[model samples]
Target: MGIISMIIIGLIAGAIARLLVPGKENFGWIGTILLGIVGGYVGGTLGSMVFAPHKFTVQPPVNHAFLGAIVGAVILLVIYKFVRARV
Candidate 1:
């Protein structure tokens, strides 16, 4: 996917993730976008490992990527909360 596509997907995925995970996130639009982008990479990597261990590809399908992005974002958000609480 192109940079713009990634950004758009990231925005959507981030927004959806924020909605699913209930809590107060201080970050705004840019932070959300970055979270989603990172989540996409994290999710895509893990998804490939689980789903297609043998056939590892750099880019997963759009649907899978979207789902993975949300899951990844949620995981990150949870981790963030935990770290914040400890600090």
Candidate 2:
């Protein structure tokens, strides 16, 4: 909820996501944090749509959010790779 907590979660989620995906990511600490933060937003949004479409205030638990963050980060990384390759 706090800024510090968000940053920490982002770092962990980003690190785990990088490990799960099988490519070399050149981004460093700050990039990782940004990736995680964006991934968290994407994950939270998707989770909300999938799990509770009618409730606006409903939020997933922290653990579920964490997992979703990782999944989201992995997806972003894959997309980035594809886009970069095409550029």
Candidate 3:
């Protein structure tokens, strides 16, 4: 169940993340997929950490997996940008 959910969220989050970010991204399809999954975990962890006591029914909202993915993607994107700039 968790694995399936992660995949779904990864796809959605990766799409949303790409939209949120400005400019062009050079990652291919596979890279994007990986980014999304990682992003979801990142977003979920951060969300949970910061709002530990806020209990909002679903709390973590499984649907928000995409958000997590986006967070992960964004971080990766930033890192890529920074490294690219240095190179």
Which model scores highest in TM-score? 2
Please, what is the whole-model Cα lDDT of each candidate in the order they appear? 0.85, 0.86, 0.70
Residue-level lDDT of model 1, residues 1-87, one tens digit each, is 899998998888888888888888888999899889998888888898888655546655456778999888888888888999899
Every candidate's CA RMSD: 3.9, 3.4, 2.9
Reference-based TM-score of each model? 0.85, 0.85, 0.69
Q: How many backbone clashes does candidate 3 have?
A: 5
* Candidate rank order under lDDT: 2, 1, 3
Q: How far out, in Å, is residue 5 in model 3?
A: 4.0
Give each model's clash number. 0, 0, 5
Model 2: per-residue Cα lDDT over 1-87, one tens digit each: 999999999999899888888889889999999888888988888888888645538664557889878888888888998998899
TM-score of 1: 0.85
lDDT score at residue 38, model 3, on the 0-100 scale: 79
Model 1 CA lDDT for position 51: 83
